[model samples]
Target: MEAQVFQALLVFVYTDTWPEVEQEDEPAMSQHLLVAADRYGLERLKLMCEDKLISHIDSNSVATLVSLAHTSSVPK
Candidate 1:
């Protein structure tokens, strides 16, 4: 689990998927990083994950997202 998270973080940190080519991000990717962020005291990374999760939230996923946020000890 930690290995996968580390790999994803590697991609996120090193790759420059941008205006010309957007990143093919997985929904759970940011969530995984959120855990690592908390564990390692990566504040900027945590904020980035929070922002990503916020943008992905919607009516259909609100309940699940809220639950995940609570589980992660994130502020609502």
Candidate 2:
């Protein structure tokens, strides 16, 4: 996990909430968090990160997002 993502995960663990992230960073942060969430078996956090990713889907991001979705242990 990245330092930023790891910090966010720790915050979520302690407070049951994700720390604020910049709008432009949201998608990338969510992707990292999704993987970390799965690795740590944090199902609810995984879903939350998935939801964040879903909202950001667009032509510019679709290819990378699809690749990540296919390669990672993100739910199908």
**Separate clash counts for every candidate:** 0, 0
lDDT for every model?
Answer: 0.67, 0.87
Clashing pairs in 2: none
lDDT of 2 at 40: 92
| lDDT (10s digit) by residue, model 2, range 1-76 | 6799989999889988876899989999998888888889898898899889889989998998888888777767
List model 1 lDDT by residue over 14-62, tens digit each: 6622112124454577777887777667677778778777787778768
Cα displacement (angstroms), candidate 2, residue 43, comes to: 0.4
Off by over 4 Å in 1: 10-24
**TM-score of each model, paired residue for residue:** 0.64, 0.89
Q: Which stretches of candidate 2 lie over 4 Å from their true place?
A: none
RMSD of 1: 4.1
